[model samples]
Target: MATSVLVLGAGFGGMELATVLSDELDEAEVTLIDKGDSFVFGYSKLDVMFGREPAAAVKLPYAEFTKPGVTPLREEVTQIDPEAKRVVTDSGEHEGDHLVVALGADYDFDATPGLAEVDSEFYSVAGAEKMAAAIPEFSQGRAVIGVCGAPFKCPPAPSEAALLLNDDLISRGVRDDCEITFLMPLPSPVPPSPETSEALLAEFADRDIHFVPGARIA
Candidate 1:
């Protein structure tokens, strides 16, 4: 009999896990589940916002993935009983010999006052579309790339946005008229890698982008 693996949340981790398991174990039963039918890769959001890729092309449909021995289930996960190695979703219940949870991080914008009202986000496809429209209108002004909460999904994304914005403004010929600020809760941009943090800081200084360490978005 094959080992049953139930993987929750079809994010990067879950996808890689299921694919690897299916390839490695011919008899293994792998089930990948997520509420969303498709995904826009984290970094791909920037491409859509910056006009590098079309919104339609960037979305990868879950149903199209043809990984052998892996079944994709699109359903909402309502309950998880780890002790029993069971999970309950909107439509059904599942039991497996092993369970893996890779439900990615969600932004808590309410943590920062008035952040929800700004409606300026590049994390989702819709948000990126909005940014695509709004960014071009930014002739000259202060742009703040703030991380609302600590331990964000992609720690380096905020820095990337700040640096990208600087270049974007320069391209628009408003580099001198615009100011870019990055707000991060951590003392270091990439705390684990000091070298990385230093390099990003140097880029910020060279571009004249402001870095606010240990700061709250509020």
Candidate 2:
């Protein structure tokens, strides 16, 4: 009998792993389960949030993932039992010969105070869309983007959001009235690579984007 595998999460990593396993292991049973009905890539989230692209354009329907030996289950996993090799999801209980947990990191807005209160054009798609909807209404206002912690998803995204906001204001002929700034805890835009950091610094300077480094705003 073939091994029955239950893969948790439908993110990029999990999807890739399951696809590879299904291709390599012919007789094995692989099930990819996620709570979300649609799959959206990381970058696509930004695209929709900034109003550069529509939500439907970024959404990939779960039903479209038709591959051999791969079953996509749209359900939220409630609990896991390692000893029994079983997982309980909103759909039902599943016993797998093998289990792969590729669930991505969950964002905790509570990580920083005033984050939820303030307008975050970063983080999640819904947040971005909210900002996008607000952007068109703002004829002149300070649009500040802040990063509260390390190990964030899409490190360059916050900066990108600032730049995009700058662009949007410029396109709307309100660049002169709009003030865009980026706040980060790092000493540079991208501290991992100095050259990249320097380049980003130059770009920010050129774009007139105020860069606040090594400072965590309250």
Candidate 3:
């Protein structure tokens, strides 16, 4: 009997895993599932937010993804039985020899008080698109990139947003008018690599991008 591998979520990790497995094991059955029919790169959100790329241009349809021995299914996962290597989805239940769960983190806007009403979060695609539309009208103001909590995934995202915002504002001839601040709970921009953190700090200083270390938004 052929080995069956089930992967939950169609994000980068899931898709790569399924593809590699299909290529390595010809007899293996790879099932990749996700709630959404398309995949969007995390950095692509920033591209859309900054008007560099449209929302439609960033989306990669699952229907277009083709790999030998790999089956892509769009279904909401209702339950996961890790021990039994079984998964229950909205469509049906599936049993597999191996189960890989790569569902990304859920962003809860309500976690921070007054955040949903005032500021836009670029972490999500919807938020990015909404901010993209609003950026053109934003002539001048204090643009704050704040991390509400620690241990958040993608540590470089806020820094990238700050840099990109500076570039966008400069292109719009409003760079001098707007003040950009990056607030994070970490002591450094990127703790793992001092060299990277130093380079980022230099760029922030040169661009007049304020870095608030060991700070978190309430």
Q: Best-fitting candidate, measured by TM-score?
A: 3
In model 3, the Cα lDDT at residue 206 comes to 99
Tens digit per residue, CA lDDT, model 3, 1-218: 89999999989899989888988996979999999989998899999999989999999999999998889999999999999999999999998999999997887779889999976878888999999998889888898889998788788888898999899899989999999999988999988889999999999999999999999898
List model 1 lDDT by residue over 43-105, tens digit each. 988888877788888999999988888999999999999999999999999999999999987
| Tens digit per residue, CA lDDT, model 2, 1-218 | 98899999988987898889878986868889999988888887678776888777888998898778889999899999987888999879988888888889998787678777875544666876786687789878787788878767877877777788788888899999978889998788777789988888898999999999987766
Global lDDT of model 1: 0.88
Give residue 134's error in model 2 in angstroms: 0.9
TM-score for each model: 0.93, 0.93, 0.96
- Looking at model 3, residue 141 earns an lDDT score of 87
Clash count, one per candidate: 0, 0, 0
TM-score, candidate 2, is 0.93
Question: After best superposition, candidate 2 residue 173: deviation in angstroms?
Answer: 1.3
